[model samples]
Target: MAEYITEQKRTLKKILEDNCDRAYTVDELFCKMQALYPSKAPGKSTVYRLITHLVNEGAVKRFIKDGERKAAYQIVMGEHCDCHLHLKCTDCGKLIHLNDKISDELLSTVQSTSDFSVNEEATVLFGTCGSCKKHSER
Candidate 1:
C-alpha cells in the first residue's frame, strides 16, 4: 500500500495552515491528501485513522450540516474560543464569522432568561446578505 503521509502529523499541520476557514468533509480531505501525494494515496482506513487522530489532538474540528452522514472538518486556529457568532445568508448561504463582543447585559439576559449557556462558536444567525437583500428588493 502506498503511504501518502511520510510524516502524518506534518501533513495535517500543513493542511490546517493552508486554509483554516475552508471546511472539508472527510472524503474531501482524503481527496486533497491524494492530491498532495498523487503517487502515494492513503487508503480509506488510513485516512479515517488520520482524521480521528488529528481531531483528538485538537488539531482539527468537525461539524455537521444539511443532515449529512459525514461531518465537515477544519483546522483549529489559535485558542478555541466561544467569542464569535456566524452570520449565514439565507438566500446565498454565505457565512461570515462575527467576532464582535456582546454586551454583558445581553449576554446575561440570554443566560438568565433562557437558562442556557451561549456558545459563541456554534452561534449562527441566518439573514439576507447585503447584496442579496438589495437584489431581492429590486
Candidate 2:
C-alpha cells in the first residue's frame, strides 16, 4: 500500500513546486506557507519534518549555500534529481539546474583522471547568474 500524505505535506509540496527555480530554508518556507494559508498553516517543526521526509523519499533536494546558517530545500521534478548539477546565484539566491552533456563529460573526465567520483545529485556550484552579472555591470 502507498503511504498517506497529510494536508500539510501536500501544501508544502505545492509551495516547493510553485517556486521550483529557487530554494527556501525551513523558516522561509514556513513563513510563505503561513502567508498563503493563514488558517491552515502548520508549525515550523511540522514543515521541517515534512521537508525531511520528502528529501528521504527523493521528492526534494536539500542544499546549503556558502555562509548560510540554514540549509535550503528545493523540489525535485522528473529527471532533475539525477540528470543535472545545480548552479546557485550568490547575489539573488536563485538556483538554476544545469542539464548539459558537458557536465557528464566533465564527470567522466574527473573519474578517469583523478580516481574521484562526482556526486551530481548533491553537487552545487555557486556563482553570479547572467542577470546578476548584468545588474552588477550597470
Candidate 3:
C-alpha cells in the first residue's frame, strides 16, 4: 500500500490536484482544503508546513504564473513531474502541461544527440482559450 500521508498532507494534495489550473494563497488553500476535510481546518502555519513537506518530497511543484502572487504549486503525477518543456498561452493566460508526442526515431535521435531525457510530464501549453478566441473574432 502507498504509505498514507497525514490527514493535512493528503487533504492539501487532493485540493491542489483538483484545482490544477490556478495557484492559491494560504487562505485560499485552507478554504479549498476544508471543502474535503471540513472538520479539520488548519491555520496558515499548518498549511504552509504541509505544503513544504509535499514540496520536499517532490509531490508538488512550484512555479510563478501570471498572477498577483509570486509562486503557485501543482501536484505532480507520473512522468509529469519530470517535464522537459512547458507551453504558455499569451492571449488568455491559460497554461496546459504537455508531454512530447514524437516518433520513436526522433525520440531516439534526441536522446543520443542531446544531454536531456524525455520528461514524460505534463507541461503547461499556453494559447488563447476558446472563449478568448471567440471574443477576439467578434
lDDT (C-alpha, whole model) for all candidates = 0.65, 0.80, 0.62
Q: Estimate the Cα RMSD of every predicted model relative to the unseen true structure.
A: 7.6, 6.8, 7.0
Task: Identify the runs in model 2 with alpha carbons over 4 angstroms from their true place.
Answer: 1-5, 78-95, 98-138
Each prediction's TM-score versus the true structure: 0.51, 0.57, 0.53
In terms of lDDT, the best-performing candidate is 2
> 16-118, model 2: which lDDT tens digit per residue?
8877777899999999999999998888998898999899998887877444768989886634447767787877566786756867988889999999999
Q: Please, what are the lDDT tens digits per residue for candidate 1 over residues 22-124?
A: 6677788778878897766677677778777778887776665333566777665523334555566666444554545653355667989999777766567
Q: Name the regions of candidate 3 deviating beyond 4 angstroms.
A: 1-5, 78-95, 98-138
Which order, best to worst by lDDT? 2, 1, 3
RMSD of 2: 6.8
* lDDT per residue (tens digit) for residues 11-120 in model 3: 78877766655556676787776676677777778888888888899877665544345556666543343433444556534455444444334456768999565543
- For model 2, what is the error of residue 113's alpha carbon versus the real structure, in angstroms, after optimal superposition? 27
Evaluate residue 2 in candidate 2 and report its C-alpha lDDT on the 0 to 100 scale: 24
Candidate of highest TM-score: 2
Better of 1 and 2 by TM-score: 2
